[model samples]
Target: MHAFRLTVLAGAIAAGAGMAAQAQPATPAQLAPIVVRDAPHPLDASRGDAYVATRASAALKSQADLLETAQTVNVVTRAEMERQGSTSVAQALRYTPGVIAQYGDTDVRHDWLTIRGFTPARYLDGLVLPFGARGYAQPRIETYGLERIDVLKGPASGLYGQSAPGGLIDMTSKRANGERVREIELQLGSHARRQLGFDLGGQANEAGTVSYRVTGVGRRSDTPYDHVDDDKAFLQAALAFQLSPRTRLEGTAQYQRIVSDGGGGAPALPVLGTLQPTSAGTIARSRYVGDPDYDRFTNTQTFVGYTLEHRFSEHTGFRQTARISDVDTDSRRVQIGLMASPTQAVRYAWAFPESARAFQIDNQFHTALTTGPLRHRVLAGVDYLRETAHFTESQLNILTNASGGYALFDPYAPQYGDFDIATPPDGLNIDQRRSQLGAYVQDQIEWDRLHVVLSARHDRVRLDTHSRQAAGTTTDANGDINRTTFRTGASYVFDSGVAPYVNYATSFQPVPGSTRTGAALRPTTGKQVEAGIKVQPEGSRALLTLAAFQITQDNVSAPDPQNTRFSVQTGQVRARGLELEGKASVNDSLDVSFSYALTDSEITRTNAADTVGQVGNRMAFVPRHQASVWADYTVRSGPLAGLGLGAGVRYRGSFFGDLNNTHALRPVTLVDAGIRYDLGQASARLRGMQLALNVSNLFDKTYVANCLGATGCYWGTERTAVASLRYRW
Candidate 1:
């Protein structure tokens, strides 16, 4: 199977290259004008424009320029997302290289992602998502109201504080861009799914001083199960005011709600004796046990920011930015299923439920000073966040048949089972709060052909916990943790259009849970060493980068035997990898982008005797090899003028399920294709209207996305299709 997959991938690459060679050269008449826009602030002049704005530098530029960053950044533009008919974040990232999306169940609300071997830290316009649980689960944020999605790989701790060592994702909101626009869309598709959305944005005055945008989305759908369903709605609005020629202010507010009926399957059942058949008939009985489970998740977020720029003289100018935000989230889930059982066939039936409410406030300030022959940018900020997590559970009793199968519940019969049964006082109402105070500074030095960056930060975090039970008993816990990190890097540009750079950076993560000794474990520390080469031919439309890096972490935690849910900080791990990424626009008629990663990770030290021999094992869910390629061609002349065709393929190597490397899931390949036709009519109602169709997993491959330590697992999605239409002014 692996050999066959490789052959197919090789063939596709060859075919794409051959097609590129046969493509006709674009002439001046066929070339689209590339217009450049001014930076939001004078200090932002040094930063590259991007097609999808997310990072601090990119966010200040025009929204459409986010695709021009020099780093290995990928953007899912609104146009592409609509064309692909993406309903969720996972679906949008499917074709992005070095990104892995794993769905534990069929329901899309519980989906999660891992990028560059690290879990994603969700953000909105550079602000942290207010409510993040330990399991990487949060209230679903609808994508319908977003302008674009920006994915930044590598440590962004220089700007964003308390982040994962891997990277960060910023969801840019739709805002008024000084244009009058209004549109409505309706979609009906498989699974009895229906969706409706409307967008409004434009200037309210002739002076272009006042502008606003409002967006709303609602969806409903039924799954293949008997009682499984999904419902969601979202509304967002933004207002912008121009204070003067050199200053501006903007404010935004958003609200979202998600409700789901327990319909998807549960984690895979253990295969203790023998492997089960692959036929759908053999797996039909593996249904989600929480037949009556129901959940509601809601989020409210608001932000207000201002941008200022002034020129003290012709050679000197000052730029300043400030922003404040508030976010709140509430969630509740009522689950009815089998919690646990020694034997797989006769699991006990019960009801387990949970809820959480979180709130946060953040503020940031930045300034830039540019003088003759010297430029300095300084960033300083303070962040404070507080969250309260409440949990409750109860046990229920239900009779079963002799064959270990129970009769289905009759919805009409209210007395089929005991709905109010009490269990022991094993659960508690817990309130946890975290306060973080941080400050950072960075300086960028530019010489004749050299650029260097020096940065450092110090963060102090305090955690407090208080717990109470229904009986009025209470317990309290408190701890403080602090870490200081720094990074230095330099890039040298040559006349030959080649640039070489190297960097060394450090990161630290505070262990959330307690240790075996009842003492709070210290923060885990990590260091990364990387070197890379970048090439961009003069006046050419191509960019290439190759980087090799090694990362090591010390004081990693190992599970404590006394506490089933906690671990002791006494382990170490290391990872090394090589990455190659590039983009080429052969001309206005053709464009291609590709990325490949080779990663190896293992446990270097562990306190557990049983895990000593697993030093060479691959890390869980970390594939050794991953690659993706995308290409598109636009017809220059003929009846098919302005028509475009696109196709891409993604491949992931096999990976282990446990630290011991005892079990493995086979690798898989996914393919996507898209086509777009432009209906040109400058004055007609359909002016610049485009129609697109996309198909994913064209071969309909079946593979496992994840497994639960040989006990349970999940399978990837099957083939899917989406069609869409868009009109631009």
Candidate 2:
């Protein structure tokens, strides 16, 4: 089945490439000048408050190189993605500092990621992707469908509205660049993994009045874990039209579907034993009872949006955007546990777990205005989001006789018998509704050889929740929650290759449930102060950035002194760090990018009984040191002009899994290498053709990527290699 799917995908890519090649070519006169910068720097001048996608050539800077703006940002480029053979967003982020990917039993589905000690907030073209506890199997948006990924570290509450303090990831989609282009790629790797993708963009009409771009990807792969497999498909299309000489309009839509049949969790480990744990030792006492027969999960997502822009005059313009998105997921999994005493005779019991479903709808609108000198760039936006989660949990209480002092179950099949079990109501439902409104203004001032920018924003957010259960009718005492936050920043530039900036930002998040004493906990607050310097020397293709930051979060919560399970707002945490990043293109033959971070996070105050000495302990999963480096060398002249060699290394320091800092996980160091050969031609049936090979985890290092408190820990993958072929016109 997987082979057939791969064949069909390959055929589709080939056909798409052919169609794109047969299309008419666009003339140079129709193409616009798109700037390519050495780093991911914000627009020096105000175009609008909202971020706009620029050309990849301009945004393909190193994660560290983008830190000069006083805001922590990481940029992952398409070239890096190809060289690393990144199959998913998680894989692509491996080399990014302060980001960690936690893989479950299956490699394709069931992957989770965290950034800056918190879960990642997914975004596509600056729009948030709805999330759920049960992993959303939404087809891992293929990198081939993307031009670049920008990660803004820390609370982006000012612009993103309701969000986590962790960070935000923005995926920039491939768009029409007023140039006729076509590309097709095929990848083959271990575990029978196969993938095919295609992208095409060009002017759709004469006079450069209309343009369009389309991208598609399909993949099928089997995991090393027993009895697990995954399949995914995706498609995206965009159209742009020049309404008038000063006005432009664009519409975009994308669809994705994914299906997976696998269920796995981290294996439990001993506390005071070896530095590096092995799955072999842990699985010995663990039964590989696969999830119930009905265990499977699937996800589907669709997004559509439009943007309109108009230039009122030479120095002023206005733009407005609106979008709607929908996501649905269905999952079923059986509860499995490990036995403490494997030497004793025992029976294994199975639960008849039913299913869970999540459905979400999101709508948003944004408008911006930009004007003249001493001028103001103003932005206003609003968003409405709704989510419904439903699940059915079955209670199982049965014991079966053990054979040879051990319980055994078939890996592919498991038996469940009813023995006086109580079943819950048909469905348990939880519904959430969120509304947000925001406004911001920024000013840009120009002097002889100096430029300065000042900006501020305010946001108002509200959340409402409702739930239905069989036990009794319960209403959230907090009812409707509201919060308001503010932020400000300033940047100055000098002609001598230096730009300095400072920023003060704030964030707020509401806690869902009330405290033990029946008092509603106010929203938590986070504040940060940061300063940075950016350098771009004259006649040099290198960009360097250095930054220092201090952040504090007040009104943190902990278990109530009276009630252990109930939480109370009586904690404060602080984090201070320094970062260095740089990117350079040396004489068009070599490109290098790197970043490093040193962070110190600790609890400033805590009322919890067990958290006194833990105040100075490091935050869970936050490495004290992290760094990455990637360099690629291309043959500039000769018969091998298009050949390239790439090498990269990523390192992370040891981190604790618990707040108390008792359980520690070993650090990880990974190396990757790749080689590519491009057959270049100006204009032909296949204007460009290329072949490449990538090897990840070259040394097959064994380490844990993440842990769930004391329960268990996830392990990293071994070495893997992939080969790919590409054609472009």
Residues forming the 10-long window of minimal summed lDDT in candidate 2:
13-22
**Model 2 scores what on Cα lDDT?**
0.58
lDDT of 2 by residue, 1-729 (tens): 222242222211110100010112345563555333333223211111112212221111111223224465666766557666777787777777777665422245444666666665677655566553233423356667776677776766665555666666877676665667688888888667787888777787678778877888887865544444566788888788877887787887777766656432332333211243333233322232343333455666777776666667554555555556666665444333433433222233322222222222223222223344342333344444443333333333233434433343332233443323233233344444545555554443443333343444455555454444445544343444455554555555554567787777777765655576656567777877878877777546566767788878888887776777467887888777887777666666787888888878787877757544767777776788889998888897776777889989988888877677776777778898889877663224544788888888788776666555443444566677888989876
Model 1, total clashes = 8
Model 2 quality (TM-score): 0.80
Best by TM-score: 2
Query: Each model's number of backbone clashes?
Result: 8, 0
lDDT of each: 0.56, 0.58
Structure candidate 2, residue pairs in collision:
none
RMSD of candidates 1 onward, in order: 10.1, 7.3
